[model samples]
Target: MSAADDRLAARVRALAAAVEAAEGRSDAAVSADARAVVERAGERVAFSGSYTVVALAGATGSGKSSLFNAVTGTELARVAVRRPTTAKPMAVSWGSELPHALLDWLDVTGRHLVPSGPHELSDLVLLDLPDHDSTEVSHRLTVDRLVELVDALIWVVDPQKYADAALHEGYLKRLAPYADVMMVVLNQADRLTPEELDRCLGDLRRLLDAEGLRATPIMAVSALRGTGIKELREALARTVANKQAMTRRLSADVTVAATALAADLGTANVPRVDERLQRQVVAGLGAAAGVPIAVDGVRRAWRKRGTVATGWPFVTWLARLRPDPLKRLRLDLTPGDHSPTEVNRTSLPKASAVQRARADQGLRELTDAATSGLPRGWASAVRNAAGDRRAVLLDRLDVAIAGTDLEVRRGTWWWGLFGVLQWLLIAAVVVGAVWLLANPLLLGLGLPQLPPVLWYGVPAGTWLLVGGVLAGLLLGVLGRALVEIGANAHARDARRSLEDAVRAVVTEEVFEPVEAELARYRLARQQVAEAART
Candidate 1:
């Protein structure tokens, strides 16, 4: 292979790799097309030896058989009188030995003897290929295969059928690039006058030129009258003798392969998800849940109230001044007569049925934008898959929030009251003790003269009793306040956690997978573009 050929191959391989990396799937059609091109290249490589294969191709009744006979100076190719008569190919070899490799490659088994006549052009192998305009598709395919493998082509045309639509549209337009190795013969020219032949040959040349075959050689010939046969033979012999025949064949094969490979570059439309849509989804969800509001409520409640360690009843009531986090989002958490459970967000903004529908529509719009212009079938498939995922996401969100304990626990409010009553009982005992000691009536019963014991002990005992009761009451107040604060904090934390969880479930598990599926759809668009090129 040449350096340029190597570079082209490397470029194709790199394209395959880049496509695979970006889209996570290999280009199957591209690889298949490349393989086919490489196969054609290999065939051309094998033809670089001593062989000159000439292909005779044209539409039915174009007189290719007549020209084939005139070029070889023999009636070898059956000059059928009927239209579309050549059912199989006929090979006429010039040299004593047949080019077995070329013949086998062409799959031409039918061979004939060229009688010892004009042996001047002894190196050329003339193959009378089947008509491309034959009714049988196999015959047309055979002609097409020969067109790719042959070293040179002779397009024999009758004046009447030279401009036939099938010959021009199907074959001439496609094979125009090989005109360097092609020659157009207006065969059976004796049937037409000089003016008619001139006009037809001129038009044929113009058509070939229009098909990208500038300076393509055109000759007028009559196989019956032996007109221009020697010139055609000389042209064929010169083409083989110069060793440019194989080069032309290789170039033709390259063109054929390139054309086939180009077909695979068609559009494969697949839709995807846009990042803007994703951001919108996240923002909408955050707004609907009122997460920021709930967070703010928790922060205010935390600052206004003290810790639960302080046992105070008044402090607990102070904690209630702030709003409940769940309540702020309108997620009702009033515990039922049964066990404690999560509050349902039936009345929450955007959580209502109509609001949910709108949110779903927003998500769908984002998904649609990501995968815009993708095929309806592929889009539907991805949408179905996303629908399944959204169900799972909603279920998971419900489960996370539902599992939180939102009900008031046991000993919540009564514990602080019990601490207050205990302090009061201690105060009563201290007062009774003081009164018993100071009373003159109680001392008359031979009680020892409590000298100054009442003065110091009674006051000290009274101060001790009041101080102990106040300390217990303050502790009770602070402790109860702390408990309410802690509970409030827990509720706020649980709400935030649930918000995040639900968002992630809807976006990652639900939205992101949908996005990936949409990406898959977008990547498929290459197939459509490829088809257009083909």
Candidate 2:
């Protein structure tokens, strides 16, 4: 084998290792697509070096029967009189040493041992596959799996149907990527005139080129007449002699499988969250929970500057008194408090079924777009990851909104009553204090300013009235400030909780899967590069 061929074999081994890694982590939140590809690849690698498979693939009645007989030098495969008779695969080998391990892996137990012949093709273990246009679905699957794993394929096309659409569309188009390991044989040249044969060959060449098979070797031969059997034999012999052809074929298979496995890795470039969307979600949740109104009311009532005694002491006491509205209503709005004690659906906006459905649709669309460049299996993995966590995501969001709603406390009429009683008590105390002092000189100074009744009967009545009025005004301001403070705190708490919830869902359900897939892909790619080097 050439140095290049040695490198190619090594590369295949490396690719196998990467696939094994994926399989090992199959249960660890891996994408379904990635897992499938890795599993397929691992199976192939496990069976490598077990057997040498040379598959005969071609259009219907392409004289592959004749060619198969000539190569094996036996009537092991039925010929012309029995054209298209084999409806299934038949294998012939020249020796018993042809590796039972390989045969077991191919799942073909009906093995035949053909005696070694003088023909150069004797060393090969030949496979006469069923017609590509077979009526059976099993036949098609057999052909497909063989095409994926076979060391080399001999594509036989007779003059009559060299350009058959079924062969090109159903087979060649899909196998274009494997062109390097494929060979096109223009069989049954005996049926055409020299000029007609030349034109047919030319047409076949053009078709092959159009199918992205420019580098694949094309050969013309008459399998029945055995006109070009010697040349075909020599070509097969040369490939076996060097061992490079087989190595290159294996290398190409490894790369193809690797490409599929690597796609399990999520996208390298992640789409970021839009700032506008973030802001909108935050505002929407806050407004729907009535956070702003609560905060504003508290701020307006609670003032930092105020006097308890000089300005209607009774009223001032009422303003300074805090309602503790959220606490009284049994709202659990403390930091680190995740769920609400009670779900106030009336105050909070519930995500409707329609909204949940929309979210699901959006997730599917985003996942599809993110994995558009990946293999079908890898794309499937992303989809499963998104689907599995969808309900959980919605539920967490609902809980967050509900939790916020409970914190948006509205100071009701009872709070106003409490304010009034607090002020009245302060007024009573201020009146009693002046009455107890009973200072005649201080009372006389205010006597002239007081009403005649107040000057004669009650000494501290004027001062008491002024103190009660000032106290009421101060109490009203304090009530407003307390309400505002509570509202602001609740709003901030809800926002933080929501942010945490969102991040948790995204990481567990989305980012983790993406990371696992990427790891598989990176490993597969590494294997391909290493195998190529070997």
Best by lDDT: 1
lDDT of 2 by residue, 402-437 (tens): 444433334445455645555685666567455545
Per-candidate TM-score against the hidden true structure: 0.58, 0.59
* Candidate 1, 464-486: lDDT as tens digits: 55655576576665555665676
* Regions of model 1 farther than 4 Å from truth: 7-54, 70-75, 81-84, 90-108, 111-126, 135-153, 174-183, 190-195, 209-217, 224-274, 282-359, 373-534
Misplaced by over 4 Å in model 2 are: 1-40, 59-61, 80-84, 115-123, 134-145, 190-200, 241-270, 293-313, 316-323, 329-534
How far is 102's C-alpha from truth in model 2 (Å)? 2.4
| Candidate 1: Cα lDDT at 384 | 63
lDDT of 1 at 422: 48
